[model samples]
Target: MAKKQGLNKKLILLDLVFYAILPYIVWNYGKEPFGDYATMLISTIPGFIYTCYRFILEKQFNIAGLFIIGSLALGTMVNLLSGSAEQMIWNGVYLGLFYIVIYFIALIVKRPFSLYFAVDFAYLQGYARKDSATLFFQKGIFNWFQLIQVVFIVRGLFMAGLTVFLLNKYGIDGYGGMLLYKQIAGWFFWMLITGMFIYINIPVQRFLAGQQDKLQDKKTPLSTDEIF
Candidate 1:
């Protein structure tokens, strides 16, 4: 199970890197093989294919797989439609906005997507959802987990929208400049998200584990002064 979880994490990272950077590759390295639209299709299709291949090999997906596959599919759509520099620059904003809606719905329902994301990653380190083992988050901890999703959605929207505005305002017509700008800005946003996730997720997970144990009469919840 540990091996499978680690493999899942690695697969997700690879997919993110491949899908996230493919546009730049298409605009540069793949430019000669075909034009922009063709190259976009060429680059993105294989990523989805690879994702499918992983599912085939694993025979089942980790909980995070749903969102990972959704992201890949959405990315493929945006890449395919973004044939021009303008489209490439702004399509991502559209996708981000779309996600804001979905994430907002998650918030409304009290099941933030980031909570699932956190649990899935923790699975790599041996966390489990089974009631007999690692306990899932209860109400209070789940609220904190939702905060993670809120922070993520807000940050993603701001960064993506800001990028679109900056590109258009400056008239960055070339793929090179646009892609470079996205790469740098993307790293910035991801860094912020990682930091925020750590701050928000860790304590909540610990609390949830403690609460579960107490309720189940396992170890019983104990006080810890240093809990963040």
Candidate 2:
């Protein structure tokens, strides 16, 4: 699982780099490839293909796959119709919407997506002798996962909106301006999100674990109590 996660991380990083660089390259050398629209379309294809490959490797047959497919379709459709910078903006919007939907689906199913992380953490805690065993259904972890999903939803929407606004205001010609704004906003948003996760998530997990420890410590010894 750790190896899978590491591979996923690498793929995501590569995806980010591809998107960030390709747009600039297309915007600059668009004339050679039947103009900007064609260039943009061609450039985006590789990322779409790579994302599909990643999904296959990850064996994500659910909403994660749906999200990627939906985003690619929406982005391609936007480009086909408008052939404007707004298509680029739609890319972000579609991705944000995809994650938001996944978050809600997980919540409604009562199997919060954060269970993945919670289970991992619980295993680590148990291994460290901090707890007897892992309990993924803990209320504290559920709450934290809900909170994080909310944060991601908000951040995703903000990013999508901001990207649209930038594209509308500057067009594809303003690569330098767009790049500068994107970099600054991207860094700021990531830092803020990371800080929130650490602040809220870490403490909640610790608090819950501490409660479990206290309860264990107060329990009667097996020798003193009759087995049922």
Candidates' lDDT values, in order?
0.66, 0.62
Best by lDDT: 1
Over 79-117, each residue of candidate 1 has an lDDT whose tens digit, in order, gives 766876457557877788888898889888877777676
Residue lDDT tens for model 2, 113-187? 444544444454444312412343567655666666666666667776777787778766664456556656766
Clashes of each: 0, 0
TM-score, candidate number 1: 0.63
Q: What lDDT score goes with residue 143 in model 1?
A: 65
- What are the clashing pairs of model 2? none
Worst 10 residues of 1 by lDDT: 128-137
Clashing pairs in 1: none
- Model 2: worst 10 consecutive residues (lDDT sum): 127-136
Measured against the true structure, the TM-scores of the candidates, in listed sequence, are 0.63, 0.59
User: What stretches of model 2 exceed 4 Å from their correct place?
Assistant: 1-16, 31-33, 56-66, 73-137, 175-219, 222-228
